[model samples]
Target chain A: MPLLKDNDFIDDTWQRLDDGAAIPATGDILVSLARLLADFGKLSNRDGRLGVEFPNEERPGVLESFLPDLSLIALTFPKFADGRAYSQARQLRQLGYDGELRAIGDVLPDQLSFMLETGFDAFEVTERFPEEAWEQAASSISLTYQSAAYQPRRLHVWRLRWARDEGV
Target chain B: MYRYDEFDHRFVSERVAQFRDQAARRLSGELTEDEFKPLRLMNGLYLQLHAYMLRVAIPYGTLSGKQMRKLADVADKYDRGYGHFTTRQNIQYNWIKLEETADLLQELSEVEMHAIQTSGNCIRNVTTDHWAGAAADELADPRPVAELLRQWSTLHPEFSFLPRKFKIAVTGAPNDRAAVKVHDIGLRMHQNDAGERGWEVIVGGGLGRTPLIGYTVREFLPETQLLSYLEAIMRVYNLHGRRDNKYKARIKILVHELGEENFRAEVEAEFARQKELDVEVESRELERISNYFAEPAFETLPRLSTGYEAARAGDPAFAQWVRSNIAAHRKDGYAIVNISLKPEGGIPGDATSEQMRTVADLAERFSVEEIRVSHHQNLVLPHVKLDDLHEVWKVLAANGLASANIGKAGDIIACPGLDYCTLATARSIPIAQTISRRFADLNRQHEIGPLRINISGCINACGHHHVAHIGILGLEKKGVEYYQITLGGSSATDASIGTILGPGFSGDKVPDAIETIVNTYLNLRQGGDDSFLDVVRRLGHQPFKEALYAPA
Candidate 1:
């Protein structure tokens, strides 16, 4: 079985990236398609963290083949209006590639919950947004339904709401 | 009123469940925003300027007192204190958050209402003559057929992904109050030589930048073949309608580019192809659907009201109201009372929450519980007795809904332009208010004859401005609001797009421009009998053009 990592495991990697001026040999590198193609063979680390970036316009089938065993899949949101990435992220999750799905550039604070709901795990959150805004945005709606791509089981909002209404 | 059968109840309940699941998926990261966008649109939720808006389809603008109350409940619970009834016979809730929508839909389902196919590239609410079974001259009530079409087209997999949205309208009245001529598919019930009731089908009529009145493709179509013929038309559109440009994607554009003869042939061919498919147009299914709209429990009463003449003579306001607001009913002594939403200086087509409750009570008590919202921004009590007219008017007036301006100039169809719609360019309600106030003199409006002044904020034509007798199009000229005037448009059986006379005028000059058009019509008309539209059709725009621009 493939190794399963949680938020804690991902946070440690991010801390290392923050501390080191350059990524260590063991550190996983999430490179976008443009950067990967530009640095084709310039940098090589046999066991290093290797991940692929998916554009909104990229076909789901192409991304599905590259997802399994990948350290991370970084999706780029070209603009807020362009909602193609939401489906792309959902498709990545549905294909059972439970590594790490990080949302990179152009993601807005308003769309954070929707992004997370669509199977995006780690967020390389924009610098413009205050840290408090991210917390509030993620927890804006306390309950949700549907089994996400990353989650092991399903959770429903109706039962919780019903129970609350019933004073349970 | 058609009560929800087991099938309808089940359908709506299942839809609610489906939407709940979709919402859950969206929340849990199973369905992304892109995947959920179409899903949300299919359920009539739209992301607007401020927040999401939910448009609830008020099929044919006919609703029971109970249904109206349910809508009022939705207003109180989920949204701001009121709902705006749209031109296409839909109610739009201006303020709706995404999370609250599923609950809202569930609540709507309890009342046998849902917003499915209200938006997206699918067949929208199949609007019919609002008077339907109640209208005096109606050969047959079109609502049953409209409901059948609604059911069949609700989530029909084949046509759901069409190039653009489709609109269908049905009318049985000779006057064409449903505006059938300006729809993708317009069905009018007609009597054949054999006295058999059928439909006069018209196709391609639409309003946008290129407004074209639909041409009669099939003069008389058998009622049984209605679904088959509609399916054929939709198939033709789906297969051949332009998908290249969003602006030119409507079936009207296809009909225009293909020409009527070729388009007719294409539809005929498709109809032939689908003729063998009995699954859709089976007589049993048609009969089953038709039975749902069986005529109401109507009691035959005396032809004349002995007290009506005395009341008319005693009350001048009653007399004036009878002259303007009351329509001829086939059943003598019973009249169709149009309750104008546009009171003097009030916003057009807006009814307060209290007014809605009062209207509901009036419907239950006076009009046999049948109420209709007209395309011209007025509500109709379709079966009020002449004896009850005064009482009905009193109840309506108490609620401030007794505006006796039914087909009058004050009953203008101004869309919720820049005031509410994000799509609007300039405000339309203010212009409508100014015109209604300018022509508030009842005698002058009656003298001007039945003139429709439809104003739209932009070229989207949601206001039906293209088909108005005097159309005002609001444009933003260097951040200043300018109004363009068009002459002699009608959406009736004799449908014609309005003609732009000359340059657009500033907001201040609009009233003068309208006055010039009306005065020119008055000058050029053969007699007082000639309407503004009639005179314009006879003389063309030259007379009105000269009158407006002559050494100004």
Candidate 2:
């Protein structure tokens, strides 16, 4: 699996740990929410950066206390059309978590732009689409109607209209 | 009509290009049918029973002459020389090819139109009163707000993938001509005690498998807080709305399950949080949008038009048409002319390219280049001068666009059921056609007075059968087509879901049953002016049920 971050596929550095897996001494690691809750004391005291793979069904408020110590939060899509993760991502960002937010499972190229807008910075990509397709889909719409979590490349049309009206 | 700004133009063009690529990818087998379905649906392309059907949004039911002409051109070039005007105040071309859709959308974009958000689980087109600006009873034009919502909801990042499709309707008048109470979110304009204008926001109202009238979430929402408040509601619905069952996915179900007070509390809490983020469009932007919908220039003229009066006195046919099709405009010498697409025994809302072109020409000549598509599936020239009524009527009569059945029984709303829709269990058009022919006499229709006979092919209720005065729902029971009747429903200011009368009737027997109901109404009513709806409300459905089921 390739990790899509900022329009480029990169090797994933974080080691995903199962519920009963042994904790490494110093490298970055990802664990499920259950594992994080079960081993909170041991995991928080480690030197490595912490990440949690959150389920779509769980509310983002449950992770509020742990967000400060967490470096990354990966939200599950479960299915492409199932959009619970989009809302979860926004809520997570609103809760002031600015870490790497990744989308995993059933991710497609066409949903990349939306994922970006709703605060997903990294995607666990499958071989369902070519690399070029992902890039094209991400940059498909240069403008959006509303302000969102990731708006670096895309500007809101209202702001554009105002700028044009002011001759900027 | 609202013209597209440079940003709007760019956005629509880029979207077309994107969809063009998507379609190419699908054609090349790079995308599966499942993957392409949502994408195409977002662009208003649906695979119907016959071919692809493309629904083009006429925003707030408003269009300019040039836009109408473009629709006619698309119908002639791409479709089978005709298009169906839908109950959502949109137009659907039935014979669209997948390969040609991009080009068609490009052409539409040239006229400041696109089909984005016409379908899919997104904020669908924002509908408003077709008679918004020209109505005598309206307080303000709702189109500016509708257009604002249109721009805000287009490709909205967080809300584009909701549990189900959302519909928002606005009405500026006290009469509720937009059917606001039957939409997912209904905004009714209100003037407070201090004479300050605002919106009465209603949520959770929808007509589908489970029809529910909306509850007033906010008694009065200020004009500036519209976007933030709507964002809050959408956020709540997006997060809390049911996802397990497709049938219970609408916001109405969430509202129903959580109760109105709980839903409102959640929305208000979300709204408070969302308002802190400052996402609402600036007031200046709203003012800028409102400038586009400013009242058309009108000359100071007398209230009475001698020419119109003389024409009416001299010509009975023209007088009859005027009596039925004309509505009082806010301006002294202006009249709103409703051009009925429902002619005698004709397919309701189906208009040919020639008819479309004729309407465009008439709008250019007499109505200040403006036309409206009503939710009842009719065309309206909203600003026609009273003095020019006769000339307009003459042109309309010549072009087969003049039908003296604006609000009569003949003006039926029928969805393309089994004839074109794959989801349909039985045919809706033929049943509507049969009923229309049964009551084809204009005099008898006028005598019955202002009856809405809405027919849907399936339980999805695309034809708005739940809100009709005499609602007919078609079903397939054991491989046989049967029509279920509901009485005393209305989509007006006093909105109520219709109650089912009794057992279903065969397709051939529906007309007779409807005739029996109408005759029963006439027999029970107080006088000529008492309408079929009035009779139904006064006497209830028992009489109608008995009359319908009585032994012949």
Candidate 3:
């Protein structure tokens, strides 16, 4: 799977581990939530940076205590139409998670803009679409009306219009 | 009445470009129908029974003369020379082609309008009272906040794919002309004891397969905190609303399942959290938006127009029109003129391109270049002078726009049904037409008094059958169409879902059944002042049910 980040395909360094797999010695690793919960003490003691594949159904607040030790959190989109992960991503970002928020599974080019706005910094993509498609999708809309996770500092249109009127 | 500024123009243009790309991709077979359905719906395009239908949003039902003319042009160029004004105060062209939709949208954009969020699971076009600024009893104008909500909900990233579609309605008056009580979220303006006007927020009220009246979540929410509060409600619903069954996915279901108290607590918690994020727009921005809706200049004139009175006395037809269609205006010299789209035996809300153009001309000449599409599927000249009413009526009558049945029995609300909608189980327009023709006599309509007969082809209640005083729902049982009747429903401040009356009737029998119900009301009422709805509510559904079900 190709990993998209910052409008380009990037090499993924994180290794996904299945349940009951032998622990890798020294590389950054991603495991499912159940694995992390079941093996929290051992996973925390590992030298590799930790990441978890959070299910969209679970609330993001459950991962609050684990945030200090985690470097990445991958949210699943079982289907593109199911939008629970967008809310989870925003909640995770609001809970002060500064890690790389990765979107995995069923991701498509058209959803890139929304995923980016909702604070997904990385996406696991299949080869169905090209890099240019993703790039175009993310940058297609030049303006947005509401504040979002990716652009918290970006002012809403009303404020921008007011500032422009005042010649600020 | 609110013109788009530079920012709004740019935003809509960009959205059009985005949709153009999406449409191109779908045409190229890069996107499947499942993926493209939602995208097209977000832009207000639907694959109806025969052809593609495009619903154009007239935000808060407000349009300028230029906008109305453009709609006429769109109908002439892209559709079958007509458009249907919907129950949501939007207009739908039923004969659209998918390939020409982008161009149609492009044309719409030039007039500061687009079909954004008119359909889809996100927040739909925010509706307000059609007589917002012109109504005599209004506390304030609700369009400013409605426009603000329009901007906020447009392409909202998190909410675009909610459990199901959401609708919001606002009203600035105690009398709920906007039908606020039946929407997913209803905002009614309220003044505190200190005369500080705020919002009374009602959540989870919706009319569909499961008709439910919303619960009041907040008695008086300060005006400035509206956006944040609504965000709270949306977030709570997005996270908790059921997705397993599309029928059970509205916020009303969540409110009902979790109980109103629990839903309110969840929303309050989320609202507090949202407040901490400081996402609410500044009060100055609201003030700026409100300035656009400020009252138009009116020339001071006497309370009575002698010319209008004389015209009324001389022409009985004109007098009847004035008595039925004209409403009191907030300004002394002006009156609100309702142009009924429901003519005798005519389709309920369909207006020809020529009619649209004539209305555009009339609006520019008489109504300060403003027009309103009412939820009752009628057009309103919100600010016509008393002296100009006669001339306006003449033009309207010439164009077949004048019908003295604004609130009368002939003014029926009907959905496209089997004629244009794929979801309809039976045809609604013909039934509505038959009923209108049955009550074609103006004297009979006036004698019957104010009544609302809403017809829906399916249980989705697109025609608002659940809220009508006399409701008709058409269903197909084993290849034959049958209609069920209900009574005493209202979409007003005193909102209630109608109770099913009795066994269904055949398509040909529905109009007679309706007449029987009306005659029963006439016989039972104590005086002329008693309305059909008042009579139904006071006497309950037994009398009407007995009349319809008794084998006579």
Q: lDDT per model, in order?
A: 0.75, 0.91, 0.90
lDDT of 1 by residue, B316-345 (tens): 877877888888776777888888888888
- The A-chain TM-scores of all the candidates are 0.67, 0.95, 0.94
TM-score of each: 0.76, 0.98, 0.98
Model 1 score (lDDT): 0.75
Candidate 2: which stretches are off by over 4 Å? B276-281
lDDT of 2 by residue, B268-363 (tens): 987876633343445667788999989999877899999999999999989999989999999998999999999988999999999999999999
Show model 1 residue runs off by greater than 4 Å.
A1-168, B27-32, B279-281
* Order of candidate numbers by lDDT, starting with the best: 2, 3, 1
Predicted candidate 3 versus true structure: per-residue lDDT over A103-129, tens digit per residue: 998998888878887888999999989
Model 2, residue B418: displacement in angstroms?
A: 0.5
For model 2, what is the alpha-carbon lDDT of residue B476?
A: 100
**How close is candidate 3 at the interface, in terms of C-alpha RMSD after superposing the true interface residues?**
1.7
**DockQ of candidate model 1:** 0.02
lDDT, candidate 1, at B157 = 38
Q: Provide the TM-score of the second chain in candidate 2.
A: 0.99
Q: With candidate 3 superimposed using the best TM-score fit, by how many Å does residue A21's alpha carbon deviate from the native?
A: 2.8
Q: Candidate 2 lDDT (Cα, whole model)?
A: 0.91
The numbered model that scores best in DockQ is 2
Grade the docking of candidate 1.
incorrect
